[model samples]
Every structure is written in structure tokens, then in C-alpha cells.
Target: MNILQAKVLKSCLNSEEKVLYLPGNLSQFQMALILAESSKFNSFIFANKYETLARDYVNKNSSSKVKFFLTETSVADFLPIIDKVVVFFGAVTPFIINSFGKIILTCLRTRTPLYEVPHGLFQTGQNLVDNSRLINTDSFYDGVGENLPSLTNVKLSWYGENGFGYPRTVLKDAYPARVIPKFTLVTSNTNWFLYSLSDKRMFYKVLFDYAKRNSDEIFIWCPHPAELLPNTLSHSVIEFRPSNLLLYGLHNDIYFYNIESTDDLIPYCEYGISTVSTCLLDYEMHSKRVNIFNCAGVKNLIAAFNHASAFNSSKEISHNAKIINTGMLKNFDALKFDQLLSQEVSKENFIDYNYLAAYV
Candidate 1:
């Protein structure tokens, strides 16, 4: 074994190695197949260790004999115990990149074949490898899927299974919010900063503050799946729902809102708000509102307000919203803001001003 492989193996002690790989966490039902394979292979799937949905799916579907280990287990600890490795998803994420690299080297030294599923081995860009190590990778997703013998015979193809598959809903029974709306906002913790990159956590903190100010409105601050730990759900204005179905169950008038990353919540919000998020594209299929937050500097204030109020300022804001240019500040210079949020702040720190202070 190479030096890196040797190091990884030594840390694994003497346990037999078994591993599985997953491209994405959405394939929760696939755990049955993985667990079945585990009994013969001593394997584990490569995925985010902290993802709640993935773990929950496994726990509910897997037999008691199957062992589910998190990705946090060190390569050294995992390599020695795994007898076979199967990757489940298209490889992405920093954790997967590092862990998979170590595994690749070790497998090369050990002469173990790493099995890849359909679409599991494709690299969309040159980022996956350096020029020297490019030849070994394979992609099942790239094979020509449709063959057309003539102009009339040509068929257009797309990704994902679009059959009339049954939709799975998460069931939760809990006290409903005081005021439920036809449409509500749903944001996750992972992209919390996306609302306002300048002030950290301003996205959520500000939103909570706004909700408190407008407690009469039936606004829901549905926590991201991973953000609903016991400690994270403390808020007064918004009703917290652990299951998206329960949140969706409340009303059909509900609309999903996200700032940037919607890797997980895209499907839940069939009607979406489009801006920077790719998930918004999926929502466009329903022709939902795709309002853009026009003001640039107030990203922090806007994020906080959206999170707390459970209402997007964009709903009230428009391209023609009043604007005033304040003279320059010390370092960042003068700024402009919506009359609603900017009316109170000096030009110098308009963006820096706290929206929560108004709610508190």
C-alpha cells in the first residue's frame, strides 16, 4: 500500500472493511438495498454524516441487523473494516472529495474494485481531478440514452424519473400556529448567511425579530431539516414544524421561499420564489412569484426581516421603491435602502443597522 493508504489502514486497526457510496441524500428508500448488501459486504455508504433525512430514512427502513455509520468515522478507522465499497451518488462536497481520494488510493493498492452506479461517476467540470489522474474515472450518466434512427424517431431526454410516482409525505402531529396562512416562507439554516452575507446569522435572527413584530400574521419559520435540533427551534412569532408535510399539510396556499441554496427543500415548495437559488427553477414549473430583493446593501437587514417576519420584504418592496443616496461613510461609503428599512439608519451604516432592534 502507498504511504497515504498505509496510514489510513493503520488507523482502521484490524477490522474488516465494508463501505457504500451515495451521490445524494434523497435516496432514502435505497437504504434497504444498502443494508441487504452490508450483511454480505461489511460496507457503509459515503454521505454527509449529519444529514437528518437520510439517517431517518435508514432507521425507519433498515433491519435491526444493519449498522449505519456516519461519514465522520476516520478513513483509517473505516478502511480497515470495509471489505467492499459502493458509491451511491454523484461525488460532490468537500468531505466526499477528501474521503473518496483516500479510498481511491487505498483501493488501488489493495486491488479492490470500486463499483459506481448510474450517473455516479460523471464529472461536470475539471474540478474533480488534476490532469495526471484523469483517466481512471468513469461516468454512467454520459452513455447515449436515446437512439433516433430518423427525424421522426428522435427522442429528447432529461434527468430524473418523472413518472407519476407516489409522493411521500412526512407525518407530524403538533399544535398549529396561532395564525396559519395560505402561503408561508420556508428557509433552511445551511444558507442562513445568503440572506445577508455581511452580517452572519442576520438572516435568521432578523426574521425572528420581524415575526415578533408582526405576531398577528400567520407566518411560519419552518426550520431546515437539520436545523430543528431541540436547541434551534426557540422562537415566538413563527410556528415550528419538524416535518415538511405537516407544514405543507396546514394549507394548499403555501409557497416555499429560499435565498440561495435549496439543495434539500426544492420539491417541498412546488410553488417557489426565484432569485439566486437553483431550486427556484423547479418552482417556476408552477409559475410562483420570483421576486428579487432589489436593494443590495440591506442584505443583512433584509435577511433578518425575512426570517423573523416569515414575510419577504419583496412582497411589499418593488423596483420603484423610494431611494435616497446617503453621503459616504468612513470605510464602506454612503448607501441606499428601501424607505421602510432605510428610513431609520444613517447612510454610513444603513446595511449595518440591525432590523431586529425594531422588532425587539
Candidate 2:
């Protein structure tokens, strides 16, 4: 069958089943594939016209088991039956959120359960730990003071499920995965804000100077997807995408350092280089060598590698954040993420449908 036909068929079959709400581009969908599979509910991911890449990526990544549907209509259709709705990418703007507030208020007036699973994008900025706040069935915060609208009848749960296993680097087995040459500069996407800011130009400047002075070790720069300009890296530098970097044939004597998203870069604990970001909490759980950077919000991200020597070790941190209206889930923890999902659906209840059938 043709692609459109298949999508239609898929939707028809899953019309009465569980649905998952996701937004953003293809990459968001791709990153969410593993997590979605772990949910207790049989997922039918919804998207918008702008998210074609994400729709295709999720479909491909899950072997078409995960269904896709148009966003608003899908929301209207599924919100009643489904116990929880995860707003993965915040595709729903303030307008939608406001409208949802009304629906939720109605639900509250009638005493029904409604929840939101925000996948990162909240607050005004893009930093992992910026002006952001968690939006669930329970409470809402602007990351600082309590958001006034304080939702009711909804409980806030942690962000992820446990069945996917501890997070690990995706391309871990890639060629240059293990060998971190001394001059290696590992980085995350530059275009997106860690907290609504980009540190690429500043960090790159320091890296460029360091490379010019020490022309001995091969300087390798691994760029983030949000980062578009690796070509401008120093002429003597070796720019490698994660895929190709592993295969380029290099020797064993190497060291590694990375300027990545605080949450993302924490998985790399074996390396001794100190890092700066709230993500250090996860890393500290594994590696004791992490150094916490004290700057708050986007500014710290902009100052990249300015004083590499300033990296300092940190004690375990406790995020005393609060949420409201959560039914069972009250906080962010791995088990909670799983529990909220597992209790919702069972293996036998999941059905496979042809998404293309929806178009028919």
C-alpha cells in the first residue's frame, strides 16, 4: 500500500485505543520513541502539519506500531476516554493550554482526571533549567513562584519511564565513541537554547585559541544538531559527526571533554573533565569528578569554557519542586513515570492498526 493509505488504515484501527500527545520536529519524536514504548498505555501519538518529519521519524523508529494522528481533532476525540495525556513537545501553545484549562476546569467541575506530560518546552526560554516549570494535572509553576492558575484534579508525575533502562548514549558503539583525543570538544546542539541562549560562538572562540597554541594533538569538534557551523572550525581542526568520527581510524592515546546540555552530557561519567550545569546531579550519581558551574539560567551557557579551571565539585542536590492535582503521581521519579503508565494499560489490550487507513 502507499504511505498515505497506510497512515489512514493505522488510525482507523487505533481510533478507540490509547493516545500519546507529542509536539515539535522529527528529532523530538525520535528521542521519544524509546520512552513511548515503555508507557503503560498503548500509544497513539498525535502531531500537527508542521511535524511531518517527527511523524515520519516516530513511525519509522517504531516499525509503525506507534500510530500518528492530527493534533487538535485527535485531542478532542481522545481526551475523554484516555486517563492521562502527555503534552510531549508543547505543540499546544498558550492558546491551546488556555482552552485546555477550560476543558480541565469543566472536568474538575464534573470531577474527572486530566494530566499533562510536558516534554521540556515551557517557560520563556530553552535552557533545560531556565524559566521553565512542569505542567501536569496537578500544579504549574513558572520555575520560581507558583503559577496562579494552579490546576486541580491532576497529579504531577516525574518525566520518564524506567523500562527503557538507564539512559545511555545512542551511538555509543560508533567508531570514535571511546577514544576521546585530548583536543576533542564534545558538544550538544548550538541553535537551541539550554536556557534560551547559545554558547557556541563564545566556546568556539576559546577552543580556537587553545587549538592555535597547542597544535600537537588532533583537535576534533563534534557538533550538535542545533549547531550548523562546524565548517568554520579552525583549519587544523578535525570536525566529525558522531557517525563518521568513530570510523576515521585514530590511535588509543586520547582524552575527552564536552560542552553539552546539562542533562544530556551527564551520562558521560567515565571521563574526568568537570562540567557545569544542573545535569551534574545525574552525572554525580555515577561519576564523582563533576564540577558544578554556579551561574544561573542562560548566562552560564553563554559563558562556555571561559574559566575551565573554575569547575568545582558539588554535593548531591534535592529539587524540592511542587505539583498540584496529581492523582497518583506526585513527583518526578523513574518508577513513578513507569507506574503512571503501566497501571493504565495491559499487554493484551494493545492492538495494531494501519495508520494509512485514516486517510482512506
TM-score of each: 0.32, 0.44
Clash number for every model?
Answer: 31, 39
RMSD of each: 21.3, 12.6
List, residue by residue over 1-360, the lDDT tens digit for candidate 2: 115533335343443446454444443454355455555556656555545655546555655466666656656666566554554322224544543444433333433333434333222212233444543322121243233222322223232332222222232332234443333223333333332222434343444444445455343333333344444332213342222122111232232343223333334333222223322223333333322222244444424422222321222211111111111111233445556544433322222212211221
* lDDT value for model 1: 0.33
Candidate 1, residues 98-186, lDDT tens digits: the string is 54555554543453434433221111221122222223223211221222111001111112231111111111111133332343344
**Candidates' C-alpha lDDT:** 0.33, 0.36
Q: Which 10 consecutive residues of model 2 have the lowest summed lDDT?
A: 317-326
lDDT value for model 2? 0.36
Model 1 stretches astray by more than 4 angstroms? 1-19, 23-44, 47-55, 62-101, 107-180, 186-271, 281-289, 292-360
